[model samples]
Target chain A: MSDDNQHQETFEDFKNSFNYGSRSDLNFKFLKNLSGEDASHFFQELLWKIGDSFNDGDFTRVVDHVNETQAKAYAGVGRFTYDDSPFTPLRAPLSQLRLGLMTSSGHFVAGDDPKPFGVENMSQQEAETRIDDFLKVEPQLSVIPMDTSIEKLRVRHGGYDVRASMADPNVNFPISRLAELQAEGRIGELASDAYSFVGAASQLRLLNHTGPEWVRMFQEKKIDALLLVPV
Target chain B: MEAGGIPTVVIGVHAFRDRLAAMRLPRTVITPHPMGRTLGAPKDDETQKQVILAALDLLETAQKPGKIIDLPGRYRL
Candidate 1:
């Protein structure tokens, strides 16, 4: 079969795997006409557009057309809301304050014996399948020292695709860029280590407990400001 | 982090703008990119650095909480 035919078959198989309801608007015939790379990009963009609708609660318009199980899941996926917005002004000049980097991109230094968040030895496929199970696991933070090279990092996350991050850890964890900024004196000093966690985990635990604990860790490290990059 | 007295600024994608708004994070810079590639396409150093710089700038300039700045750029790769 031709490459285009194979891609079309794959796309059809993927579509059949999910219950997209009676949403005829999802017909992606145009995708089959594009090159593989362009098709992949368009598909990702489509998913994000759908995700935005879900987040905005606009997906309800098609909820009735979807199966009961899918409809229930959609209804349950409400965005979390907090009662207050917190703010802390920078304590010192940017040229003098120590800075830290953190990400929800599920990254860890390569060759680490025990991976952070109990994701050691977990494959991307397994991670995707165990999303809910992973969410139940206690949030674990991995420390990546500032000196570690980007090539020495690996990503494993159940929440979203990790291909982009695996190719360039800076896509979500911009440690190298932060270091460059430090070198240019744009920031005072980069913290000795950066942090990462699987953002797919329980937000309640994070907000009430793990998050505070992480903040305390940052405090102990004397980090003046934090830059969070969430995947 | 703001409540803990260590200021924080989030560099996130625009797709999650609603969720981010709901979370009431201290400070944020929204980039028009996909979920996985939050900064930009892989290996796109220029765009990635720009996003980082934007977040850093927000850290220094943001005077209040819940400030979500839309970064003016798209994924270049």
Candidate 2:
């Protein structure tokens, strides 16, 4: 019933206290803005999406590409739209689930004396220098590219800057010409909607985790086809 | 694969996750970038079709419960 009582024991204590102690860690962010149950559902959704989308057939080629691209973008179904009701919260063992992960999330856990994923103790003045240093190895993903002709559309999509990485430079900014092509009701013949590679990923793993769900939803809706345009 | 009721398409900007959405009975992957603009608003029908077609391709090939289909050549299509 108490907040601290959720997992009162440390990994060491858990090891000595419970059967799953080795896998348990104190997830600091786990309780932040999370309704426990919804978080659990989200995790369930992760498994389901992978099951429904990953198969051995014509889609074989797509498995890796979609996983890689999205594993680098999106977040938990990218947060439900405003129109929809929020998800439920359930109390579950998050620490036990992420024990073997390479993720920067929940880096501190299960008696290892976890530290916050990134810089934890830098003065405000040194923030820029720190970010610059981090960018050297952990560079940020640019949502928009430099030579993008779809600048206007980027703004239209509701973003401050449309940046992208040099190798995968498919920003959401579609050119006016492309937009024109989409408006004339010509694209739906082959697919449901044209691609718009503009939006920013909330979390790197979100895209990958939520990918199958997107595919399933479109299919269930009888979309017939999809033509990812990649800005 | 007891993923509940009829088939449903799960939409997300990434493919690594969404296991839960897929389990919601039906599932698929999109591997796009942001979640908000899956269809890329303000664009036209042709542009939207690009997103839709790729989605369709997933459904077409998807068979098992945990499929990870990736249309790397999505741009070409």
Question: Which 10 residues in a row give candidate 2 chain A its minimum summed lDDT?
Answer: A98-107
User: Model 2, B16-37: lDDT tens per residue?
Assistant: 2453343332334454433223
Candidate 2 residue-wise lDDT, A54-162, digit = tens: 6633443343443333343333543432222212111122211110001111111122221112544433223322333432232122222222343222221112112
**B16-60: candidate 1 lDDT, tens digit per residue:** 777787788889898877667889888898899988888888888
Residue A192 CA displacement from its true place in model 2, Å: 17
lDDT of each: 0.75, 0.32
Candidate 1: where are CA atoms >4 Å away?
A1-77, A113-120
Candidate 2, residue A231: Cα displacement in angstroms equals 19
The number of the candidate with the highest DockQ is 1
Task: Determine which window of 10 residues in candidate 1 chain A has minimal summed lDDT.
Answer: A21-30
Give the TM-score comparing model 2 with the true structure, all chains together. Answer: 0.25
The positional error of residue A172 in candidate 2, measured at the CA in angstroms, is 14
